[model samples]
Target: MNHNLFGIIVVFAAAAAWGMSGIFVTLIIDSSGCSSVALAFWRDFTTFCVLLLYTLVTAPHRLTIQKKDILWFLAMGCCLGGFHIFYNKSVMMNGAAVTTVQQAAMPAVVTIAAWYLWKEALTREKIVAMVIIFSGTVMASGLNLFTLERINVTGLMVGFIVPFFYAGWTLCGKNIVNRYGAVPCLAIAFGIAATMLLPLQPFVTQPGFLNCKIILIFSGLIGLSTVGAFTFYMIGLKYVQAGIASILVMSEILFAGVYAWFLLNERLSFVQTIGAIFVIIGVAWLSFKKPDAASE
Candidate 1:
């Protein structure tokens, strides 16, 4: 396949993995009885350990960075940390479906950042695709306006903020990967984020069950999912514009809905099914090849 096609596939696969994240999270919590903050720490710590070994064995040279770049790594790490912290809190408060829908805002944030930071063109087509995707995500999330009583205020506030940190992480990640390569950048970022979160263990609640077998299995699952997702995302980011990439990622909502319906026995309404179709259409439209542009 061509570059664009490959990038689209990689990004969509990453989104699918992320869509399953909520399921794994629920499993780790329900089976292991771990708090969300603790899970966040374990997720990052597991990812950091696996990626570190992979980096060392596969490409140790990529790990080298100038002293000046340390701060950028730290900032990226903080961004990643903030995204996870707020996102887990949102998931706990608002439910995974609603929080994932709220993250649809990442596309808009990415578009604005791409325009201002990278001088990427803001074409009408891109804008329309973003809107379509956002609408589809909202629809796919099965959000009921009538059930306002079920909504948590803190969750809504934190959910709204997640996209900002997510956007920051993606934009900064694109830059870092361009310079230091994806694996090394991800390794360092995960390490720093895990370190930052480790201190919170004192303040956060611990897991009720401390089964070693369960913890190891959950850690492996989370580590594999995170590593694959981040690696694919970085690869796709290399070949695609940040804004369009972000829009394509809205497919996660559809995937998440499907997973919830199957795994959690959650109802998938007709409206949500229609929303999933719209999301697929929008992603395909955005990823479609432009004949004239291709010829140029």
Candidate 2:
């Protein structure tokens, strides 16, 4: 198989595995009723273990401090930690389907950021893809947040925080991919993130604040999906062309929807479903286009 094809296949398979996290999270949410803080706290702890082992294997030497990158590491840690915290909160507040849509919008967030910050060219293909994805998202979900009752409004807004942080991680990841190496960078990133969330650990001990089932869910999320999936993404991205690697990763949303439907018994409205399609198509276009092709 072509290296690019192989890499993309790997990244997406990683994505599919990640897609199931929602189902797992939802299972805990419904059965265990985990508080957002507690859920995030436990999740990070699990992530810490995964990253610790990974770094030991790939870049044990990176264990030594790089003082220059401390600030950068802090920022990356904050972005990543913040995303996980708020994403779990979104899951608690608005339900997973809506948050899933917000996550789907990450490519748009990253694309625009790359254009402005990295001086990446926005080629016709990219423009079209983003537009289509945005249109699909809007068509499926509709931009009007007011349409949903007052209750949904907050959830939707919080859900958006997920993408914002994801965009941060994307750029931050790009910066470190060449310098720190993906495994060590991620391991360190998760370590910093874990420290950031440690204060929230108190929430885990209080019975009212959390329960066993929720802890189990959080444990599961951290153990396999969170770190393991990222490990796969970094490893696979190395083998594949960046473009194709990204497109295949869209499988996450697809996986989320399927899992949500069966496990969570959740469904999106017609417009939302349409929006999902648009997001998928738009992101797919982005995958095939090169940096130059996108700029043109």
**Per-structure clash totals for the candidates:** 0, 10
Error of 1 at 239 (Å): 0.9
Q: Where in model 2 is the C-alpha error above 4 Å?
A: 1-7, 137-146, 203-219, 236-250, 262-280, 290-296
Compute the lDDT of residue 249 as modeled in candidate 2.
64
lDDT string for model 1 (8-64, tens) is 788998898888877676666667666777877877887889889998999998888
Error of 2 at 286 (Å): 3.5
Predicted candidate 2 versus true structure: per-residue lDDT over 50-85, tens digit per residue: 777877987788767577767777787788888887
Top candidate when judged by TM-score against the true structure: 1
List of clashing residue pairs for candidate 2: 121-295, 122-294, 123-294, 123-295, 136-275, 137-275, 140-271, 140-272, 140-275, 141-271
lDDT (Cα) of model 1: 0.81
Q: lDDT for every model? A: 0.81, 0.67
Q: After superposition, how far is residue 51 of candidate 2 from its true place, in Å?
A: 2.0
TM-score between model 2 and native: 0.80
In model 2, the Cα lDDT at residue 203 comes to: 50
Poorest lDDT segment (10 consecutive residues) of candidate 1: 287-296
